[model samples]
Target: NRAVMIGGTTGILGEWGPESEENRYEGAMTARQALAKSKNGATVRIGMTVGVDPVIQLCHAAGIRSPLRPFPATFLGSSEITLAELALAYTIFPNGGWRPNAPHILDRIEEKDGTVVWQSPEDRARQTVIKPETAYEVHSCLVDALESGTGRAARAKFGLKKFPAAGKTGTAYDFTDALFAGYDSSITCAVWAGFDKPQKIYSGAFGSEIALPIWVAVMNAANERYPAKEIAEPKGLQKVEICTRSGLLATDKCYDTVKSSSGESVHKRTTYVELATAAQMPTEPCNVHGEVRTRLVRDLPASGFPRASLAVDPKQVSPITAQGPVLLAENDPYNAVNSTLKPKPPPEKEKPETPSPKSSEETNLPDPTKPVLKAEAVEPDSTKPAPKAEAVETPATKPVLKAERVEPDSTKPVMRAEAVTPTPQKSPKQIRRAEPVHPSDQIPEEDILRPTPPPPSNPDD
Candidate 1:
């Protein structure tokens, strides 16, 4: 015969994701969800935020050896922990955040043969971390978790009588450790399964399988033996049906969900799946950014193009040029400049001559100044550059090596076997100049340069 009375039937697995926003376990799931899943992502976030130090402090306060020994993962059940010490945290939950004495004896005096070494009251005081209700609320979340959540397998496998149960399952990365902790009105106990070498556990097996069934077995046997009173739902909690899909207040439109489970009715309230299928558009996409806003909202125009610029025709036709006519000092576009009518330099000025001062009458004359300027053009520097220089050939030493010779780099570039620093050709002077327009009539430089992208807004910003 088995040593303990088994209460419930053990069942299969339940996943938390594909439903919850954080992918946490449902209706009853709480911090216990972390333990239930052995979730690294969830536990890491919790331990990082809450600090392992505080949990370790609680562990020590609960009369256990330090749990925060190696690293933060120790807070995450990453390090090895004894079953008895693991239950220490649970003791805090039941005792309203106070550490249990776990005290055995006190005030025993000894005779000649049997001696009593000490006689003093054992320390029994509150080691408070949070209010009693806070611990209880967390305890309640765990209890809810056990009822129909990750620990549901235990409840389904064997029904423990008159004793409420709250607990969690733990599995390590690569199935290094599988553990379960369960507690009732009377006692809290824990179980673990792993080889000394931390070998591979059963395929697809977790704490729910390897450890929790044992927890249920042991806790149920203890409950049957002791018969502790069950904990009723606390006064503060109010139950309301929530949509599984939406995670919101249930609505009439939300329909039922069905999942088959071993011919047993597992009634979990879930939302009706919202289905949207794409259809061919009745109209074309807007040209600006290719959105079908008008198709969605009727207030928009039939064609996505914005209403055309108001067709305004001036009373009198004003000739407009792409390069606007220059503005004069009076801000009119008719300004003109004086021109030099001199012919290309005359052939006679190629000869140098004896310099002579001009008469006052000649100096005062504009035409007289023109002829004198032509005489100075005969300087040797005026010789047009040697045409060969235009296609300047670089020597081997000059760093232009044809295919065979290795060459060093020169400041100037070599192209087509010649060193060339080709001077850039200048742009032609503006034939037509611009005249400023009124700001309201101005077409912005930005419009001429580049257009802006449509905004994030439904109707573009």
Candidate 2:
């Protein structure tokens, strides 16, 4: 069954993000830990690896989009979306792997003394895009999240333990958005707290602190008010103990053994948690490597030391928002947050496959010596869709950028072409396709001057 995983980094990478001078925070964390900690780096890594298109496609299918561009951070609530929309989209996960529109209700059929009416049939379509196991796995990790990690405060404050629960919290950039979303086998609920005029919340505000308590309150009220019957836990599930740090089976030296509600340690018996989520928790140090080390410390913070990354800093999610053209693609923010990109090597003298250009062409185009993107025709269409595959784009259209993306692009030209030969300047209509800059070689004259759409940006050399 197909599944839709949500809540990704909107640009705030914590430990998992590549080290940078500006993005100072780095500490070892697993996916579960990253999510639990609301680590920016971990979320970005997961979203990029899984491919933003899949999750976002699901959100759009479920009708969710914010003013923020479709960058990686959008998955993290960096974008502006209504609380109502957020609630609706998250409900998809618990509806047995259904899309936002899956559980369609029919018109109310009524028969009364004064009113008699026939109703249209309900939309009864049911299919599994994701295995029931996948949903269960995601749910289970979230359940632990409320107990351990950042949500621990929520567990204690809200009295949410009355029922088994699972959910995620979000804090958007500038404290613009705060969200708490969770679901059970039978019921799903989500909530958002933010302002209409974009005022930042109290400096320490976050999903767990600002939003979760509200969710718990509503949930308990729901149990009493609506009184929906609980969904049964899936069968054949047994508790097990394993290292929360390394998803591997626990060793005698396991730093922390994950304990289930049954009080069984992961060491003695296996407890069901999210499958991919095992290595994701920061519960303990790695079995073999110990821990991924950097300047960041595992020691709990002192009073003024800052708690959550989102609350501590808004720039974690979006450091360089583009008020103009293109922002960094959510998945490719490696170049965005870190100012010091891997430096390219000096240009080498000669090469054959690249056509040595005439001096005249060189002058007319951008610098052949500098790095620029050139769109090359595909060797062949390996990306072709299978006949049976559901074709996503209909009446194929050219790949073009929307003139007005939600945010401006944050790209920089760290290296210039080695040769003096001018290459084409990238423009809105003509985007450049970036080619890897080899250590010894400069961009070939032919590659720089190719006829294609220019990139939205072209910083002059």
Candidate 3:
């Protein structure tokens, strides 16, 4: 089958645009490789091929309580699932395609008087979801995944290599969640590590790195008591030889010709894999690997032949691109980068230059070169009675004395020369301006003197 292009909103699968380099899985791959490497695009394509309805039905049967809708990312596991549900669901592999009912923590309830009030059922058969052969096939694929694929850390880091087990590692977008679901013949376990609020655990966090270690630790401790065992092969499953390069039945033509040290021609064959179960096993022979042909005879060159040789055309190799998964909310990496790198819009048309206002210090300063003019004071008109004194309280600590100073020009009267006076409202200061001294109002300079210093303190009395 030819590979179909699966594009994501992100730069994954070469979705953003055409370029020499992009994050994508370029060519077709067997279902086994797709599962082993945990490729999202391949998994989605596989789900689509199998039909979305069946996949959703399987999810419901597997105990996923979350609301699910048929969409492209459904198989990619965008929906939320609980740790307990996942652990129970994964038991199908070990239980031979049967979904085990969750066991009771307390099998029986006893009263204080030692009477048993209730007890669990004696016999309950697990619900069969698929055939035993199908489970075995899935188990086999997971076994290889642990052996060499993303779940290899269980063997390499946790020292579970000797234990016979099958498992898969799941990493959520941007490491928001990490999970490891695995099983031996007797026990199935799943481990998850993440915060309630989704956040990146850390840079470069993966399922194998974060969750597999915990699963391995628990499994190791349990195996010490229970002992590790292998899953038994069920009846009706057949074993067949298949080509390793292509997961297809092997043929005699799937061999190459090579010369031995003695110059004798020999047939070099590719490695063969022993696969089981008719549903999972290949039905067609591999066309990729075949016997290589070479000339039966060759002409000998003279001794010490020239080092220079004629150039030969390069062999064509099929192209494939390997890509990693991205967060659903993230924009295409290339597009995001290109958008940032794009030149900024020509600075904003130079704003119409606004005239800056002058500072208060500059505007209020008096001109030094101009002559100062004294204010000319004039007498009040004779006909009008003298204006009464108005006592106004000032808000400040000092009292402000306001007087009407009439200018010489008969136009508008120049009013109110404000004089700062001492507080406590006593002995107000009087400012006398030169008012031409009307003949009838003139007083002797001696009479205008201060009232003689209040007769000195009465020491005689």
RMSD (Cα, Å) for all candidates, in order, is: 30.9, 36.1, 34.7
lDDT, candidates in the order shown: 0.53, 0.55, 0.68
Error of 3 at 193 (Å): 0.8
Best by TM-score: 3
Residue range 1-461, candidate 1, lDDT tens digits:
00111221122111211111123223332244444444444555676788877867766766677435746656556555566677766777766656555543345677788887666766555566555555666676677567766667776765545467788766665556788777877787878898988886854467777888788778867876776665543344444444444344455545443556776555454432211112211123222222223444356567865676646664333333223222222222321221212234456654765555766955554552233222221223334543332345877577653444323355545443433343433434546688966687455443432223446866654
lDDT of 3 at 72: 64
Instruction: Tell me the tens digit of each residue's lDDT in model 2 across 1-461.
Output: 01112221333332233211123343455565566655666677678888877877766656565544667866565656666666666565566455444433455667676464875565555544454555556565676677775667666776774666678877665456677887665557778787778787865467788888988887777776555445444443444455554455454554545787888886433222334333333464335434444634566647756665444653433333223332233233342323322246789986655444556744566556556565443333446643453335545465633343232234633344343434355433546799867665354444332223446675762
Residue 251: error of model 3 in Å? Answer: 1.5
Error of 2 at 195 (Å): 2.0
Candidate 2 regions with alpha-carbon error over 4 angstroms: 1-26, 61-68, 99-121, 124-129, 228-241, 244-246, 252-461
- Give the Å shift of residue 70 in candidate 1: 7.2
TM-score of 3: 0.53
- Span of 10 residues, lowest total lDDT, candidate 3: 12-21
Model 3 lDDT, residue 262, Cα:
98
